[model samples]
Target chain A: MGFKRKRNDKEGDDDAGEEVREVSHTVKKSHVLPSSIKNKDQRSAVYAKIKQEKKRDKIKKTRARDAAEKKALELGEELPPKKVPRTIENTRELDETVCKPDDEELFAGHDADEFSSIIKRDSIPKILITTCRFNSTRGPAFISELLSVIPNAHYFKRGTYDLKKIVEYANNKDFTSIVVVHTNRREPDALVIIALPEGPTAHFKLSKLVLRKDIKGHGNPTGHTPELILNNFTTRLGNRVGRMIHSLFPQNPNFKGRRVVTFHNQRDFIFFRHHRYIFEQKETKQSDTKGKKVKEAKDEKSTFKGKTIARLQECGPRFTLKLRSLQHGTFDTKGGEYEWVHKAEMDTSRRRFFL
Target chain B: MPRSSTVECGGCPPFRALSFDVLGLIKVIEARGGQQGNTPKIVERWGEPDASRCIVAVSINDRQNNPLVAVGRKNGEIELLSATNGDRRAAVIAEGGAIASMHLFKKEQSELSSRSCTLLTCTINGKAMLRSIEITNSSSDSNSTDDPSTTWNVCSAGTILCSSVDGNEKYALFGGKGVELNMWDLEKRDKNWSAKSPPKNNLDIFTPTWFTSAAFLDKDDHRKVVVGTNSHQVRLYDISAQRRPVISVDFRESPIKAVIGDLDGNTIYFGTGSGDLASVDMRTGKILGCFVGKCSGSIRSIVRHPEFPVIASCGLDGYLRVWDLKSRDLLSAVFLKQQLTNVVLDTNFSGEEPTSAAANSSPNDANAVMENQDEEDTLGPVKRKKSSKDNKQSKKHRKSKKKLEEEDDD
Candidate 1:
């Protein structure tokens, strides 16, 4: 009786195994069952063949889908919608080409216009001059000198080197340039200038720096606001013109004198030719009387000794500046060629250190 | 009475299971289980050589219950890969500008017999497209078959930097550098929604100018959108009531790179360019906590694990770190050796783990090993305990010698 019951149990187990296999086969398309009533080795071999067939079938289906997508694209037809749009606007109609420019070409000239605007010298840039507080002795004097030279410049005592905060401050105040004097020990070592709003910061090494006391200068600054200001001076010709105008200012101003000219240095390049009002007397040809021609003229001249006065007039030079290439930071011969206004060798004969 | 009965047994003998050491060890084991032991391992990495073409957007969807990860590149290329084995499933080129954002949604009820998935992609130039994917698997016949098809549609044409769809996929929001926050009703297919302007604050003279990222809160009934601005402000807007943000909070003092909210919508997590990841309680406007360690660059993406109390983040530093939310401990950090812009986790991904080439020799692993050595050197208690025993023995010997000397004198 035990043997008979064991046989029944074995049959029941076999039935359950068959049911599980059937269910797995039905659920997974990749799973395949051997059909031949043969040896286990032969059944396994058939299953392997089924697996390979399924893989090949999958590859074939994928290829077909790819081909169909390509064909639909070529025909310029909209592919079927994935989701039924609840609103008409959500349904995308493929009307434009999918192909786009390559990355290199896409980003190549993206900021071309913006760059042109940034480098364009449209007006006199407002400058913010600052000095590192660590070298207070030398930095303050240098910063003060710079502030006096540049009209729109203001002095900023840097407490910390937080670039973000400095930039934020500049942006709020609408400063167009930021010049920071970095000192080593007790001497100024480098001048760091950044074009404000955005930046292409330039660092210039300092050497042979002569303070105002070392150079022959106007006894006192005129403190005059020029009626006209020339900005972003470029080329040797502009330098000559700037130097000639700078020479017109008197070494010392009379207490009552209001007319003055200023030449400011920025980014190593000199931006110059600012001036105030100047008055001149009109010239009149000296009149000679016919009665003075003869010897008796001496006697007549004594009677006409009291002369007539000429008319006084106001006059000044009127010239407009045509902006060309904008000079970036201070003039440095060893810097990048693109940073300079003139890439070729400059005419050094025209260079003047006075301004 | 129960306590008195236990006292009758002579103050219950120490229960081994109730010991502090056993409980502490159990807690540590549980933590380990929740960390690297059970967290989804990065099975594969598809790295791009040029870091400039880093991934700009990522979308994960289950098509016919098969996980698919789609990544959009800076060069306007969209790559779809299988989440299981990282197999290349499909590649689509959407040309105009770099892909700015991507969203994947599964249709609730499809007329077609097969399940359908939809992909919505937006380019930086404001062009948006919707692609439909259908997976067909038929097992009725003796021969098994599988087929996949895709359809494309143009949704909007303009410039968009970031875009997101609501939970029900009903409304879409788009914002960027110059564009103001705009909402579109997906059902009506129009931008007729009225929005209220942000209230003016005397302290902030300049309006929030540039919006970097935005996300929809996960609340179904109350529709809210959170926007992160370049000015380091996170603003929460209630769509139904007003156009302006109801609450504006200043986050880390750097531009916010990414923003996401918890499932309950009460806690919001934000990452900044300064490599700070912090969470804030929305109800009281209080900063809950910060996740610290190993993030040295701008965090590009932060994704919370759906099942675990951990968050995975990748940033400009190129390290993918998982932080435990409760313990605030770094679980695992893997260095990809390339600047990574985005990461997506496959919540339902269950497959044979694919060996990662970088994971075996990652610098993060070496650093972790070094850290463990340093910790052992500084805090090892075994050496201290041994030294204390030696000192005790030395003291006893000295005391016995003194006593002997006294006895000799007596």
Candidate 2:
């Protein structure tokens, strides 16, 4: 034997007590650092060698796994189960208030809720968009974009009139809802959506707003009603908020416009996006890879030709909204009862999600 | 704060009928676990799917050993339903203008144990009428049950915002927008005393006298009243002293929608539009604290159990929450599925109520009597025995649990 080693150092290795390689006639070098090594330079060199060996071992293990997978596929065996990574959403706490799909009570309640009339198409939603009392330069531009995004929406000037008076006027006008843009330092930072007449108002703290001119390769929105897509609004409170937003749009969507608006709520942060989608046939490598999985599953090595897939192009005015509070009725700054209030104390746990 | 893991309603007063006014229905939950343990089962469901008859106000009179609940609909109709079963015992068309409030009580001169009950209902436009229900025959069938008569109007002020009866039912307090707090003598049908609006604030802004909810502070005295305003202030009015509030406390920024008095007169429980259920010390004018369970909508009704340390709250959130008064913790909560307009607990909810607590000195005596009633319930002994063994612990739950288990053990 070329060398001798302590049995405990390489205890976990399967080939530990095997005979030394006949060609080399030598034992493997253990990557353990000796405590007696006093010199800093020698310790640094040993550490570097150990790190390199560990990297090589990891790469070798992955290579072996790949080889085994390839062999298994060639032998027509089942593929190994994929490893699932743990995420905050996957391990979120159980929310008791989550509305089940078939909850008749919740469904029956929705049929008689505040937004029911508008949502049921019994009355069309006529939105009166207005800015706060204070003037801001970009506020007009944002309001204009909002007008384009929502069907049957009109802009009202932010004069000296109070919100309660405005709401009363809107009620007389039979406007279905009111959207007030709150600006701070010349930027629209908040959006208040108040259902008209007998009201339930939602105040949203807006962030990361990108207007039509700001987004690159953004398309212009048309007058046709865009389809609404609400995602991840599962909780009871979320259901109410989702309905409030849902009633803002017209019932029948003009699919010909090819425009779509999405309110995606993930971890309670609503992401608003407007896009124009087109379904076209494209014979590219990307589509070929998708077909490969199908062909591989059937054990038929056939090539896929032209495939039609839907593609989306951004239609501007993208933003994120976090609900600050949802008030029961109209816009009474003083005494309106809030349906849901976002307090700092609610976020005590990282994995707890309301929506 | 940790949520209470167990429902503390096991040792509750015999009045275990917890009925919540859902959209068009009144759903009753058996809180005493008569048939179900731990889980409070829905014993009876009242009301139909008729949209025209939406419920607005509910008053349950289970106090005088009567299982009758008075339900006021939006069409200004009051229907008396059997609390035990969901049958229509009687229905009367009270002044039609959309019912604002309703109360079921016996006449002040009538005996406490009298079976004859009076119904008081008011409309939004301030038209109130009373219909006394007197059973024509003692063994009356469902078809011919009640003969209602003595209908009279007690209209005081128009656009009535809030109205409440004190413990003695001698005076009724009424307040509304632009209307000052007015106390009406129910017996004499005359105005006794009216509140004077407070002076303007430092900014010369007049706090609108829009009382969203009001309650008599003491069950025994009709002088002390707690009024919640649309302006989000809780005013404590001592009518014996001044016409204005003795102490006005602001709770958050939401309008107080429900006002109620606790066992002690000083502690008042209130629920704001923002779903904050908190107690305030009337003497010191300081907020005690908000209850642990968060409500998701404006609270419409908050009723404390007459003889127990528990309160039930319901509102637009459609959830009826029963909270322990001593610990200020949510003991049991149930989702009624409709935007709840009101919630009422049967003071003598179950068979647990002592048939004769005439010589009763403490609540413990009532609990001891409850043990004799629920002895046959096999499940009762298991729960009560566990509680009795853990009596050494100072936990309110254990005390309540021990109380639920009678000293006259099976």
Candidate 3:
């Protein structure tokens, strides 16, 4: 049976070699075999030679083994046990150990007192917008649009600035945040927002982004900041409100208007809306023509009215901002937690005065 | 740890989903609709619990517009199961060793008016065997007569960790622990390259680096291969352009375990040993974002929905979670209660009916109100229906969890 199997295997090898030679003439003959056998006789001769070579190799191996065994017997020593094949357990220790970051290391270099003090100070945040070089062409339009809403924002062209240099420049200029827009296939996919001076870099995946002009406007800009800012948004709701508030601020501050509203975030939640308050007179009540006409006339009355009411209303586009990370001081690169607390359930009934 | 004994998203209806664990046990889950929570029900259970014969790799082929799941086992056995019914269709044995990876491709010949499906199974010892499954007739009853012809070639002499066939089924790529990336032409049945080592950097290192996972960029014309190394580096090689990698970027400190490219070929999603799944732009190497929640173990497999913007992933944590790629929000999470090694989504199974039903119904409906009241009663009946073998397994899982917690405390 063994001899027959060997003959079959030799035939298979010859067939495979012939197929390869037929398909590709560039294949070197030496690589397949010493030389190509032209006829059946030559092939049989080559197979006989191969068989003889294998027999010789087996004889040599057996002679060597027998000699070693005789020597061991002469020395009155038992032959060594057969070698064991290595298993997976043998290489199990090759796996590298992973280092996990702890809370103390993440919050290093910053004290509780300093963090609280920094949080308490309510200053106008200056933001610098940096676009990734690969998406520079579309970055300008996005920057200009973002500037229309954020008065303190400035655009930094790509290739002219490096991340380290820009961070240092922002630190020197006392910029509060640096927003980097990363594009995938020339489309804006994410925003990496880093809080300046001290660090808390947040990475947010952007989706469903719409320009301020695209979203229907309810009322014109008040041209005056609100006296009191109300922030009642939490979790994902707060994220949306934060994005909307980000778009409300103009690129260039309106000194003549002197009125601005800002939504600040704390601990992954929007804390409150801040604005300068301005008083306005209420409009006089007009006849309820639409309501009366709907009730009296057979035809349905349109819900439109000629008279308008002059009342204070929250103004701006609503946007959702996802908080990604919270870091400590500027230079502690690894000292930050990327995980944020997410609410298990959304409370739709929560008080949200500013939609 | 199990929390509250109730599933989240109570108002959502159940969808048909399947998950398998390291013990070779496959569980089919049906989502429930209720106000108390959307608890998943085990609709079916199959596969044996043998430690030595665990499943290592799995792939779902919907090429013929019908879903067929190919499961590879640790003992070098490949089993084909019907996606809709979980019935065993066929089985084949390859060279002895654990099956490392599997890919399904379809070969159609217009002249013969015949279509044949090919199953590529790569063993840990670096033998890639291609099995041709020929359907004799279109009728379901004739499926048993399907003949499977296998042809195998040695892609490498060492362990292979990952393997995949190109979109056109013309080329196949395989890489593993000690082997550099290698490509084989399916038509020629020969290696396309002679390079024995991967593209090297200027840093002098004597030892050869190993690849943990690899994927083709999905562009037939580009012929680019992206591989994630054990050294936390992602390298892209254009075979036609150069022998070395054209671009290489260090992703993170953790070893990447699985990788897949997006449809557009400009973005690549990778999962690491530390349970981080993120995407990076292929052109600029900028990380788009990371998907968060329910990822507590090293990710093993990630499959993106062909039509939807959702990606399903399974890992050692024994949970299969789906996430929206655009928003990076977890859409759903199912606890399969086993160390999951691989997962593949059945794209042909449209979950619209169940999902839409759950979405359309209001939480205040009378049916939901009644179901919430009797939620405990339903749980008792289901528990009683489970076989004694499954009951023992569940108890073992609980005991293991308790032991893990005790170790953590110590």
DockQ of each: 0.01, 0.33, 0.01
Q: After TM-score superposition, what is the CA distance of residue A158 in candidate 3 from its true location, in Å? A: 54
How many steric overlaps are in each model, in order? 10, 7, 23
Off by more than 4 A, model 3: A1-355, B1-17, B29-43, B63-65, B109-116, B134-152, B194-203, B353-410
| lDDT of candidate 1 at residue A296, scale 0 to 100 | 58
Candidate 3 lDDT score relative to the true structure: 0.59
Q: After superposition, how far is residue B65 of candidate 1 from its true place, in Å?
A: 3.0
On residues B325-363, what C-alpha lDDT tens digit does candidate 3 reach at each position?
Answer: 887777667666555787765555433223213333443
lDDT of 2 by residue, B282-357 (tens): 9999988889665567898899887668788888766777787888887666766667777777665434322222
* Interface RMSD, every prediction, one decimal place: 29.5, 4.4, 18.1
* Regions of candidate 1 where Cα sits further than 4 Å from its true position: A1-355, B1-43, B51-53, B62-64, B112-116, B133-159, B192-194, B350-410
| Worst lDDT 10-window in candidate 3 chain B | B1-10
TM-score of 1: 0.44
Top-scoring candidate (DockQ): 2
Give the clashing pairs for model 1: A267-A329, A267-A330, A268-A330, A268-A331, B125-B158, B125-B159, B126-B158, B126-B159, B126-B160, B196-B243
- CA error at residue A51 for candidate 3, angstroms: 99
* All candidates: TM-score: 0.44, 0.81, 0.44
- The residue ranges of model 2 lying beyond 4 angstroms of the native Cα positions read A1-81, A284-304, B1-19, B31-44, B48-52, B106-116, B134-158, B350-410
